[model samples]
Target: MIGAATFFDGYTVIAIAYAMPVLAKEWSLTPGQIGLILSAGYLGQLFGALFFGWLAERIGRMKVLTFTILLFVAMDVACLFASGAVAMMAFRFIQGIGTGGEVPVASAYVNELIGSKKRGRFFLLYEVMFLLGLVGAGIIGYFLVPVYGWKVMFAVGLVPAALLIPLRFFLFESPRWLASKGRVEEADRIVSRLEQSVIKSGKTLAPVVEMPMAARPNAAQGWRELFKGMYFKRSLVIWAMWFGSYMVANGLITWLPTLYRQHFHLPLETSLAYGFMTSAAGVVAAVICALLIDKVGRRRWYIGALFCAAIPLGLLAATGATTPLQILMMAGLGYAMLQTVTFSLYLYSAELFPTRLRALGTGIGSAWLRLGSAMGPLVVGVAISGAGVHYVFGTFAIVLLITGCITALFAIETKGRVLEELSP
Candidate 1:
């Protein structure tokens, strides 16, 4: 249910990209203005991730996840009443902040609950639903926005907001979190529940390792450990990786609908459908990566997807304002591969650092992610304005190429490694 809650949140935001054209007309927005609106959410995401990441490292992941989701509920509802572009932008930015924190913290929390052998499968299942949220968002915009207007599109956020409160009632503390916090008895209690749930779910588990008495978190050291010594290098690499991927993802996603309509001379409805279909491909890759990550190995997966992605984005750049199908197929591959790499990192970022700064470490990476998201659209928008849309796609191809090379150069493989075994 927590996973279901997150899926809906992801679905809503990505779908909004598809709805931009209608909103732009109804609200009278320009390309540069729309870019700002798209970028604002990520600006908020940066702050939200940093603060909440630190909070999770200190106060605990589950509690912070609940609070953040509830905040998401409130901000999403506020979006329904937004009357102008500025107000709508403000609401979306705040809504994005909530989502930014909710997702990474939740990923760390849930992955910690499940055991190592099945962790890949558990996250895969969770992300599959997350992608479904994208499909649902696209579909909702496709049908409802034509009749009900964009406000109704936002009103639908209520459904997930309602679902979150009840689902959280049954939530438990993360055992890894408890174990790290010196609450071994509590850790055992949660781990037993996890063992039971996995068994009842009919998933196989590895032999359990009894908690060592000495590995618990020391309160005095705090999250500052993330920036000290060896931890700093890992943190920098993860941050660079996340920043690059997010730059590509947001740069494309936020402006994509408008790009389609303008470049291909297509109707709004067709653009929405195209967004839905391609993002669905991304859904497939994300789920597959999550499912196979433990089996395939992270370093190999990251390098392969980055290289594969660069090819399509280059092709997309070469397509140069062709038919909708051409644009969709070319750009869709980039989107899907981007998502594959992105989802793989959800676990990777958290896995890279030691237990003490797991959230902070991931948060540090996500901070750059939001920065990328914030800047990507703005930069791409300028590229389109100064040159042509072809130049923008070509530029993105270069970015992807750089991203792939960097991934090959820097990332460490962490397949099948124990969570606490990761060092600072």
Candidate 2:
């Protein structure tokens, strides 16, 4: 149910990207203007991630999650009524707030429920739905945009509002968050219910190991706690990872269809098809990464994936994107690997903090993601307008190089280590 809810965030985000070709034509938009439309939700996401993440820490994750779902869905429906680029931008920004808040808070919730031994694969399987949502939007656009028009796409996004009613009834508050807030009895009740559900599945339950009470938080933690002492290094490194990864990932994924349609002048369907193919390839790569991440280790996988993703972009930049097969193969493969980096960052970021600040830390890191996501398309637009397409990919190559080196040099290994032991 959590994964299913997160699907809407990915669905709405990429749906707008896919709609760009039609929207640009309809509004007579400049490249900069189109980039703004592509990025508007991310801008809303920056504020949303910060505010909702902080709020979730105080009020509880489920309440904020419910509210954000309604907010984004309402904005999505409002998008169906947009008159022009300005109104569309307004709607997208507000919609972005809900989508943005959902993922990081959900990450904290999921991470709190799992043992460190299983977190990478478990959380990432959930994360893959977000990628699948991207592909779902592609599938929807390939068939719908050329027939029913872009408005139909926004209409499809409105379906998540129905998800809210069911979520309120079914979703439990994060036990870790509850514990952190001194609601130990409530936390224990939820955890006991989960254990009972698992036992009902005919599986033997493992004995619970209690953490020392001193290690467990009793007071609510504030965002300011993220930058003090042990957490400060983690806060910086995770922010860098989020910014660098999303800048390249969102820049490529969001702009690929538009780039194909406008620069190459491919038929509309072909461009959407190509975008869909890249997104599908990314999902495949992310799944593979999720499967192997525990064994490969987070720091090693990040270092390797970042450099592997960079090489293709470097080649694309150097040779120019004239050779279609080469561009498709190299760019597709690179972006696929980066998708691994993009999705796994949630897992990595969540592990970096203790339970009390987990949501806030993840939210703040994701805010940088929102910043990079917002910048990626705008950067592409400016680079295309002035320096050309090669420069945009080249910039990505450099950014990836920096982030990869930072990971190789600075990032600590987290695989197989319990979160309480590591963070405490």
Candidate 3:
């Protein structure tokens, strides 16, 4: 159910990117205006991550998740009614608040459920639903946008509201969260139900092993603790990772379709098709990362992926990013490498803190994600208008290179270590 919710979050978030080309033509929007429209949702997400993440730690993950799902779904419908740039931006920004809050909280919830042994693969496989949602939007845009028009993109997002029924009825709150709040009996009851379900499936259960006690901070102290002790450094590194990686990845993905249509003069269908191809490439790369990240280890994988992404983006800049095919091939490869890091950060951020702080820390870290996401398109718009397109790739390459170096020097491996042990 979390995965299903995340899928729509991805779809709704990027659907605007796919719709931008047509909307630009119909509304006669300039590059600057287009950038604002594209960025509005991410800006809304920044506030949502901070506020909802704090709320989740206070109330519970499940309740916040349900509210966020409903908020974004309603905004998705509002998107269909938007007639011009200001209205579209307004609707998207409000929608972004919900999408932004859902992922980090969901990441914490899922991470708390599994043991560290298979956590990377298991969580990442679930994380891929978000990428698949991006691909789904691309597929829909490629086939539908030229014929049915831009409103069809928003219309498709309404499908996920139906997911709320299953989410409410079938899901249980995170047991780790329950225990951390001193609701021991409630946590055990939920865990007992899960164990009984496993036994009924005819699989032998592994013996339960006791974990070290993690520090459980009071609600007032959770936010303050993020800036103290070993957590302060971890918070800085993770925040940088979120900002740099997302700034480049989202900057490229959101602007590429519009760039194809306006800058290169490609036909609408071809532009949307090419955008779909780039998004599809990211999904393929993400799947491979999901399968292999545990063995490679989180620290090493991030170091390698960041540097590898920087290479193609640097090449694109050096080559001047003149031809659409060149941009597609080089930028697509860069986006793919970054996509691996982009989707996995939630898993990384959650692992960096204890249960009491997981949602708060992840939410705070992802606020940088929203910031970076908002900046990317705006940067692209400015670059295109003043310094030219190649400079945008040049800026991204430098950012990725610095982020790669930071990862090599500061990041800790969390692959096989238990979460409590890792954080404590």
Off by over 4 Å in 3: 214-219
Over 1-424, each residue of candidate 1 has an lDDT whose tens digit, in order, gives 7778778767666755766778887777877888888888888888888889889988898788888787777877787788877887898888878888887787777666555666766776776776787778888877887778777667777787667788788888777677777799998887788679889998987776764444444567666666666676777778878988888876876687777776566788887778778777888888778777778888888888877887877876777745667768887888898888776577788778766677877876888888998998898778877887767768777877787787788778776767766552
- The full ranking of all candidates by lDDT, starting with the best, is 3, 2, 1
Candidate 3 residue-wise lDDT, 1-424, digit = tens: 8899999999999999989999999999999999999999999999999999999998999999999999999998899999899999999999999998998999999999998789999999999999999999999999999999999999999998875656577899999899888899999999999999999999888988887665455567779999998999999999999999999999999999999999999999889988999999999999999999999989999999999999999999998999999999999999999999999999999999988889999999999999999999999999999999999999999999999999999999889888888886
Per-residue lDDT of candidate 2, residues 273-336 (tens digit): 9899999999999999989999989999999999999999998999887754565688899999
Candidate 1 wrong stretches, greater than 4 Å: 194-206, 210-219
lDDT at residue 272 of model 1 (Cα atoms)? 77
TM-score quality measure for candidate 1 = 0.93
- Report the Cα RMSD per candidate: 2.4, 1.5, 1.0
TM-score of 3: 0.98
What are the clash counts of all predictions, listed in order? 1, 0, 0
Q: What TM-score fits each model?
A: 0.93, 0.97, 0.98
Clashing pairs in 2: none
